[model samples]
Target: MKILLVDDDPNILELVNIHLSQAGYEVIKATNGLEALAFLDEELPDLAVVDVMMPKMDGYTLTKRLRAEADIPVLLLTAKGELEDKEKGFLAGSDDYVVKPFEPKELLFRINAILRRYDKAVDTIIEVGPMKINRQSYEVSIGKKVLLPPLKEFELLSLLSSKPNHVFERDFLIERVWGYDYEGDEQTLNVHIKRLRDKLPEEVKIVTVRGVGYKLEVDAP
Candidate 1:
């Protein structure tokens, strides 16, 4: 697998490159977000490791662009371990966040977890009541109208619809959708569920299981 590493620190670039290379991954290095964007012009990598602070363009901006353009998964690196910074990273469409001064092994573990989630197989089309979810296209169609949600929201919806009416525990959903090592709290999952609910049609319901978790229920025809 090819990984695009974007950071302003040469040492960081070198250190991460070494570990990723030793792990059998092709490492593509970029000193800044602009340089990273330039590299995307030629070819897209399997995943991206981005630093929050950079010259010319910031990692958050780069992450948004990457999601919009290529739908590539991003793991963000930040010096601040504050919740707000992590929230920004998630809202920017990052797949995971690793604070600065982190161990390389942990980062590698998180990368593997994220890739594993992405690699899971799902049906190409799932029909529940009036909705038809297309996993391959990342779209939900209700009759003639189609809705395109963010990646996280789409994944959440897809998982729920995969086993219609089956209750998925909050923890299991988090681990399956996000990485098992997800740093954020249940609020992140709640937010995505809320967004999915708002986007979906009335025939499709995402019911909160009080204390357990959430499940998808379709109105009886």
Candidate 2:
């Protein structure tokens, strides 16, 4: 696995690089968000560990850009452990947050946990009827065309298509796609579902189970 470590503190960068390298992950070091973004032009990492405060661009902004452009998972490091701070991180599209003065072991644990969740959810490639979902590249294709929905929308579609015709409750879908600590309400899920319905091909239908939840129904090809 590859990790992009972004922080202005040289000592912190060195410390994290040592541990991540020892843990069998290739680490790419960046002193600020701009440098980190530049790195994306060359190679994309599996995940990014970014500091909340940085020169040029803050972690929240960087995280948003990363999600919009590369759909890479992010772990934020902040000095404050306040709920508001954590909320902002999640809203900006971070997968996890860690306060400063944290143990390296704990950081490694959180990184592993996030990766495990992703690995369990994604199956590399999923094909239902005429639609093809590529989890690795985060691409959705139908026939000769390709579409790239937003990160959450792609995840939602992927989960539903993973088990065609199976009903997934709204709460379960939200928890799986948005994380258990997600503060958003069901309306957020509704919006994503609607967006997915708009973007996907007609042969792939997302069926609502009324009071239960939703499922994907693929027409016979």
Candidate 3:
């Protein structure tokens, strides 16, 4: 897998690159937000490590921009351990965050944990009505069989369709499917939901509440 490492500090970049690369990952280096944006044209990374403080643009802005187009996992690094900073990171669309001066092992563990949970979710799928949602394999199916979904797409479907017609507020959906401690901006859920709907059968709808949430409803004969 590939990882885009975004940090203004040369030392941090080199250090993480060495560690992750040695672990057998392809590491793409970026010093700031715009650079990271440029990298997206060539390849999509499996994950990112962004620093809150940077020149030209901060990690928050980078995360917001990238998340607008992709669901790549992000880990924000901040110098201060302030709650406000952590909250700001989430508001800006970070999947997770780590305070600076962190232990290398801890950072590695966090990365592993995020990826592991993602793998677990993708391995299981649910079947209901015309829709098939694989919770683990990230696959969804409809009609007489099941359809395979990749990562976020399957996650969105499985979460909504699991309950079948039960309305789930955006927050509720995000918390359960995206990981209870998930820390990304809520708007990302909208993008994922749109993708899910487009992939589902025409008769099966994941409904949206004008002022509230969403639910998956199967068409009745």
User: In terms of lDDT, which candidate is strongest?
Assistant: 2
What is the clash tally of candidate 2?
0
Q: Which ranking of candidates, highest TM-score first?
A: 2, 3, 1
TM-score of model 3 relative to the true fold? 0.56
Comparing 2 and 3 on lDDT, the stronger one:
2
The residue-by-residue lDDT of candidate 2 on 1-221, one tens digit each, is 68999999999999999987766568999999999999999989989999999989999999999999889899998898999999999999999999999898788878877875777565789999889999888999998899988888988988788889988878667666776567878999999999999988888899999987999998887
Residue 95 C-alpha lDDT in model 1: 95
Ranking by lDDT: 2, 1, 3
Candidate 1, run of 10 with poorest lDDT: 115-124
Flag clash pairs in model 1.
Answer: none
What Cα-based lDDT does every candidate model obtain? 0.87, 0.88, 0.76
Please list the residue runs of candidate 3 whose C-alpha ends up more than 4 Å from where it truly belongs after superposition. 121-221
Error of model 3, residue 76, in angstroms:
0.3
**Model 2 pairs in collision:** none
Higher-lDDT candidate among 1 and 2?
A: 2
Which of candidates 1 and 3 is the stronger one according to lDDT? 1
lDDT of 3 by residue, 60-90 (tens): 8888988886678889988978989899999
Alpha-carbon TM-score of each model against the true structure = 0.56, 0.57, 0.56
